[model samples]
Target: MSTAVRRRRALTGRGAGALLAGLLLVIAANLLAAPILLYVALLLFLLVLFAVLVVHIPRRSGPVTRRISTDLLTVGEESQVAVRFDLRALRIPHGIWHDQLPPAVSGDATGEFPTDNGTSIRYAITGVRRGVWAVGPLTLHTIDPFGFAQRQQEFGETRTVTVVPEVVPLAPLSSNIGAAGGTAHTSSTRLGQGSDNLSPRFYVSGDSMRRIHWRATAHRGDLMVRQEEEESSPDALVVLDRTARRWERQGPTADVAFETAVSACASVALHLVQEGYGVDVLDSAGTVLGRLRGHEDDRDGLLVALAMVRPQGEARDIVSLFDGTPPGPLVLITGHLDEEDAALLRHGGASAPILLMTDPLPGAAEAAARLGWSSAPLRDDIGAAWEDALPARMATGGGHVQR
Candidate 1:
């Protein structure tokens, strides 16, 4: 919850009129030499001054508190805001309450201040964009009984509302892709399957004697044990290239292209998780942004992280990320991409990476195609791009799928 102190002081219509009349009467009295007019003017001046003092006096009130309807608010989502304040006594006869709202949120947060103690106001707010927005310091518009003077008082600390990036549902990976288990249940290779199919290898120091293969050990003149492979869920990487210079920004709101990329990253991560894949979100520079294992809480955490993610970093190579190991399935979402950048990504390992560019530079598409990468433009409808990448993914067998 947020509040503020006195913000401004000014004269009301009645106060301005009285002061002007008082001055006029004083001038008239001097011109006509009338003592009666002078006395009336003095009384009028006193009345105006008294009204100002009356409005400026302190009023008894308790601390203000605010509440938001939901813990999670996404961009373009609406939520209710309720503010409560204790007005023990009213020093001024009339006043209005206005809750201050930041530009990141939109709503009407104003009402008449109650004459009695304990007052509350409720209004609706729509998150205009993603970010942590300050809801307000409640402002009170106070006026004197005669409506001669007015003052505005702000109260309480501002409350923060976190608006996360919008997460859209994306299409599951095609079955032919043979990469993710989203479309089908993957089989586990744990020992219980069948001993006949299990292969034996030279026993290591850590091998248990109970698992030693006597038949293989006799033939090779060395101890051997059945190879043990545990069934594990598939995993994928969603990389967002947040190069600041690549995206164009509009005042207040984030860059449209960058926002689209963020949404795509979130959607892809969540979709892969739902499809039974352990997902890791990363930036183009190979920094891990978030990791999800198909948990309810983890999904929310990922969205929150992306909500505050900003475009950063200069040109950096991503080849180091997959230097010696293959990234099972990689999804790269970025703003602009040039031919050089596309060629640089080719050495990042053969996970049959999917490249989504908001603005693909000239010759970049040709370079991506030549490198056998599935490429598509990231747009408002993420499903379209997902669909476009499906054929390429299926043709290349997307990524290595553990059997």
Candidate 2:
């Protein structure tokens, strides 16, 4: 049979008073007449003490296991964690179970359960922040059948849960410019392009008939197919502005500009990938999130990276980062743009598309005209601007206009 051991505080009130009276009576009998009365009183006191000890020892219950609804959840979503207690070893008259959750989860309260073979308790909480949260080490407390003593047991095993930011489908920004206009320079050395044949040269020993440019060969004396120039694919680099000066002026609540920028970048990247283009991301701190590789489903990785991003002290010059490469389209996403940055972008060797995201700058229109790029204010009505800025072909998939 199962056994329980308990340590309780000394008795008080009626019990203490009765014990004192019995002791006094015993002492009085010993001092006066009746030795028999003294022996009887001592026996009664010893029996009462043994009975109290027997009632104090509490019975032990079986172990418990806890399970949560999901190991990963999104912010603003509810988490339901259920704890199951096994009581086959000993019958529990009453018990209390408390599950400890991370501070990010709120609205949790202590729960009580009546004695039974099996007890399941549930806790409901809502995740308010984005990050990883751990839940476990449920504390179990039990009082003796007689309610004179209590015991506590802590289960150490724990589980980890990740809470990600809620993803809302933002209407594409009106001021989004296609990163496609720039000069394409050719190199002396020619490498094989991914495109199919344009024309064939003089039949080499191993040349195939399929590459023979028939139309050109008909006009020329020597056998020739359409000679195709090797085309270089445009590289899509997303530049995110993260300077402290840009975000520090916002109110106590987190600045929505950063969130808007991140969402815009993510949305654009997804669209570009679907259009068979290479995409890369560059932050103000010089950290690169993605490389100019073929598109894949990397939305989760990108969002998580954005979640931990914070404003930094150092500033990044857009021109320096784009120096020395062939002219290709560049996309800049920022809250504010200074004259130096604007001049560099406008005069930069490559044709650039600047997406200026600001909350109502004093001279936004003048700055945009001087830089020769489109500009749109950041606001709830931004959808119209995004629609206008997006290349008509991109919306219709006809073909992208060269900048």
Best by lDDT: 1
Q: Estimate each model's TM-score.
A: 0.80, 0.54
* lDDT of candidate 1 over 255-289, digit per residue (tens): 88888888889988888787776777878777777
Ten-residue region with minimum lDDT total, candidate 1: 185-194
Q: lDDT for every model?
A: 0.76, 0.56
Evaluated at residue 26, the lDDT of candidate 1 is 93
| Count: clashes, candidate 1 | 11
Give the poorly placed runs of model 2, Cα more than 4 Å off: 1-98, 103-127, 136-154, 170-234, 249-253, 292-297, 322-330, 336-360, 379-403
lDDT of 1: 0.76
In candidate 2, what are the lDDT values of residues 1-403, reduced to their tens digit? 0012133344424445556767887888978887876877776576556534543454444666767685556667887877776655355455676666766566463678556767777777776655565666666666544444445665546667666555444233222233222112111222454456354666666667777877767778778754666755555556777777666564435566665665566555554444444555778666876554353336566656665666676666655664455223355566665554445444254443545465435665456546655555554333344443443423345334332
